[model samples]
Target: MNPKLRRRAAGHGGTFSRQDAVESGYTVSQVRERLRDGRWILLRRGFYAERSDSTDRPPWERETEAHRLAVHAAARALAGSAVVISHQSAVVLHGLPSWGLDLDLVHVTRTDRGHGRILAGTSHHVGELPASAVTSAEGLPATTVARAIIETSCAARYEAAVVLCDSGLRSGLVTRTDLTEMLGQMSGWPGTGTPLAAVAFADERSESVGETRLRVLLDTHGLPAPDLQVPFGTGPNEVVARVDFFFREYQVVVEFDGMLKYRDDAVGAVVREKHREDRLRSAGVLVVRVTWDDLDQPERVVHRIRQAFARAERAGMRRVHP
Candidate 1:
C-alpha cells in the first residue's frame, strides 16, 4: 500500500480526493480498482471513503455518509468551486433541530443561479463567503461556523444559532466577527429574526433527536422546564447523570431509547443508564422510558406523562410542563 494511502486509511472517519491519492502514488485507475474491490467507497468523482463495518450502518448513517460525499464533491462541482454544506443540511450535520423534519435532505451552496436545486439535495444562494466562514468536515471543507449559522438559521433557528455562535465560536470552530457578519448579511431572509424561546434553549445540551423531540413535546404541553445538565454535587458541578428531562421537584426523570441504545458498545451506555435509573427508582423517584416508535403515537407519550403528573399530584408534588 502506498504510505499516503495507508495513512489516509488509518483514520476512523475521513475522506479522500483524487489529488491526495495521486500524490500518494496511486493513479486514478488504482483508486477505481480499490473501490471496485470493496476497499473503498467512492464518495464523489474524485473522492473515496473506505468501506468497512461502518458502511453497514443504518440508512441515516448512510445518508450522512452521502452528505459527506456531497461536501467532498463540492470541490469538483465546478472549476474554482467553493461549495459548502449549509442551511438545514448544516443544521442537521451540526446535530441541531432546524425545523424538526425527523430526516432532512437539504444543503446549501454559494453560487450564481441558486435555484430549485437538485442532485446532492442541494440549494443554491448568491453570496460571498469570508474564507473564515468555511471549515472542513472530515477533510471536506464546508461553510464556516458563521456561514452555517446563517444558512441553517430561520426564526426557528435562533436557539441553534445562539449555540452555534456561542459554543462553536467559543470552542474555536468559528469567530464572533464571522458569526455577526453572517447574521447581519442574512437579515432580510424570512424568519431571520431569532426567537426568544430559542435563545433560552441555547445551552440546552440535548444529544439526540429523541431528546429534542421530547423537550419540544414537554414544552408544547406546557410543562415547567427541567434543568438540562444538572450537577450531582457542588464541588465542581460534575454530572453523574444528565437526563433527557427531569422535574427536580417531583424526583422524576425521563429518557428516550432509540435503536442506538440496543447496539454493541452503546448497550453498555444503556446498561449504565438503567443502573442510574435503578438508583433513582430505589430512591423513590419515577423513571420513564420512551422510544422512537412511541413518538409515532404521541398520545402514548401524553398518557405516560399525564399518569406521572397525576402521581405527582397525588404526592402533592408540583412542577408541570407549564
Candidate 2:
C-alpha cells in the first residue's frame, strides 16, 4: 500500500504507529522523508498526517478531508474495538452548521475504556456505545450520519440541521432505495431516523415550517409581514444587517430567535443583529425580539408585539396631538 495513502487511511481521528506503516510496506525512512519535507505533519510520535486531502479545491470545498482525518485516525487506533463518533464531531461529519453546538469531546467505548487520548483534538467520552451505530467511512469507523444528526442537531437555528439533511439527501447519503434494507440492519440501534428525516425534508419556503413558522405566527396574529431578504446596505448581494420577520410601516421589527441563539459565540452574532436593529431603530424602527419559548407561548409573544405597536401608535398619536 502507498505509505501516504495508508497514513491518510489510518482514520479520521487516530494516530498512526510505525509498526503499522512497516506492515503496510513503507519504510520508516520513507515516513521520515515525508515528514521532513513537510509533506506530512507529525500528529504524534509514530503517526503522520498529510496537510491537504485534496489539491486546489473549489471555493465551496468543504474540509470534508479534515472530517475524514479525524474519523480515520480514531477508527484505526481502535482497530475493530467497536466505537462510534457521537455528539458535535458527528454533526461536523453530517455537514450541518451546528449553530455553535459542536463536540469538543470524541466518544468511544470498550468493555475496557483505555486507548483514547492519543489524538490531540479529541477529548474522551467513555460510555455504552453500541456496535450497530458504528459504520464505515473511507474504510474507517465513524458515527452513522443519521445517528450523528440525532445526537447533535438540537440547535438554535433548526434550519441548520434541516439544511444538513437536505444536503445528505441531495448527495444520496441517505436514500429511499436503501431504507428497507436498513430497517433490519438498524433494528437494535437507538435512533429510528425520523428526526433526521424531518430535518432533511424541512421546507424553509413552506408556510408552516422553519423560518416561515415565524411568518405564520405573525400573520395569524394580524401583524404585517416584513419583506423577506430585504437588502440593508451593500457589500455582498442582498446583504442583510439582521433578520426581521415583520416590519410594520417602519415603526417596528420583529426578530425571531431559536435555541443556541443565547449561547456564547452566538452573543457576537446576536450583537451584530442588535447593531442592525439599532441602525433600524435610529431610523425610528422599534425592534422586538422573539424566541422559541415566546413562540410556544403565543399570548406572550403577541402581547409584547402589541405593546410595541401600541407604543409606536401612541408616539404617532402624540406627534399629531403636539
Candidate 3:
C-alpha cells in the first residue's frame, strides 16, 4: 500500500475509495491485482479496506470488525450527504454490542431527503433526524447512542433490543432520562411500542450481553424478578461477595457463569468460584448457577430455580445476613 493511501485509509477507519487509490499512484490494473492477491478487501462498490491479518481472532469477532470497517467505508461514500449512520450500523460505530442484530447492509437515514431507497448493500431510511440525535462516531456522522438504541429496538427482536438498551445504559453512553427523552420525541411514530417496552425493561445492572439475555429469558418465562448484582456481607461496610441474581424471598442466589471469563484458567476460576459459592451458602443462600448453554434451555433453567426455591423452603433457610 502507498504511504499516502495508507494514511488516507487510516483517517477513514481503514478504508479508501478507488479514486483515493488512483490518486495515490495505484493504477486500475494494480488495484485489481491487490484485490486478487488479498491485499485489499472490497467493503462496498468502489470502496476497499486493506486486508487485515486477523487469523488469531474468532470468527464472530472478525466478522463484527469487518462490518465496522464496512460502515466506515459507507460513511465515506456518503460524505457530504445528510444521511447519517443509523440503526445496527450506528450501533457498531458507537462500539455497542450488536449480539443478534443484522449487519448485512449499511443503514443510513436521510435527514434531508424525504424518501429512502436500498442500493448496493445500503439501506437508506427516510426520516427527519433532529440535530440532537445527530452525532459523530469514529469521526463519521452517526445517530447518537440513545437514538441508535431506540431506532434499532423498533426493528430488532425484543431480546436484541434489550441487549442494546442494557449495554447503552450500562456503559453510561445513554441514560434512562436520555432514552425517555428520545421516546418522547418518537411519540406517535410507527414501531415505537417495541422501543418503549425495551427502554422500560433495560437494566444498567446487566454487565454483559449474556447477563442481559439471561435477564430477558427469566422475565419472558414469567419467573419472579431477581435482584441484580446483589451483595452479601457479614457486617456494615464489609462486602463479602456479590452474586448475579438474588431471590430474596426464596433465599436463592442465581449466578450467570459465562465461559469467556474462565478461559484463561478454568481450574483456578472454578476453585475461586467454588469458594465464593461456599461463602454465600454459609450465609444461608441456596445457589443456582446458569451458563450460556443453560440460557438456551429455558425450561431447565426455570426448573433449577424452582428446585432451589423448594429446597430453601424445605430447609426454612432465608437471607440471614445483610
Off by over 4 Å in 3: 1-3, 25-27, 55-60, 234-238, 318-322
Native-vs-model 1 lDDT? 0.60
At residue 125, candidate 2 shows an lDDT of 53
TM-score of 3: 0.91
TM-score, per-candidate, Cα-based: 0.68, 0.44, 0.91
* Per-candidate count of clashing residue pairs (backbone under 3 Å): 10, 16, 0
* Pairs with steric clashes in candidate 1: 133-144, 134-144, 222-321, 222-322, 223-320, 223-321, 223-322, 224-320, 224-321, 224-322
lDDT of 2 by residue, 225-301 (tens): 56653335334454445444535454566766655445557778778777777776665567788775576777778
Best by lDDT: 3
Could you tell me which 10 consecutive residues in candidate 2 have the lowest summed lDDT?
201-210
lDDT string for model 3 (1-322, tens) is 9899999999898899999999999999999999999999999989999998988665656878989998898887788887899998999999999888888899999988757899878899998788989999998889999999998888888999999999999999999999999999888887888889899999999999989999998999898899999889767787779888998988899999987788779899999999888888877788999998888899999999989988988888754555
Ranking by TM-score: 3, 1, 2
Candidate 1 wrongly placed segments (more than 4 Å): 1-39, 77-79, 82-85, 88-108, 111-123, 128-141, 155-184, 191-197, 231-242, 258-262, 265-272, 319-322
lDDT of 1 by residue, 115-220 (tens): 5455544455556666666666544456665566655556344434454444554355555555556667766767666622343454436556566666666766
How many clashes (backbone atoms < 3 Å, residues ≥3 apart in a chain or on different chains) does model 3 have?
0
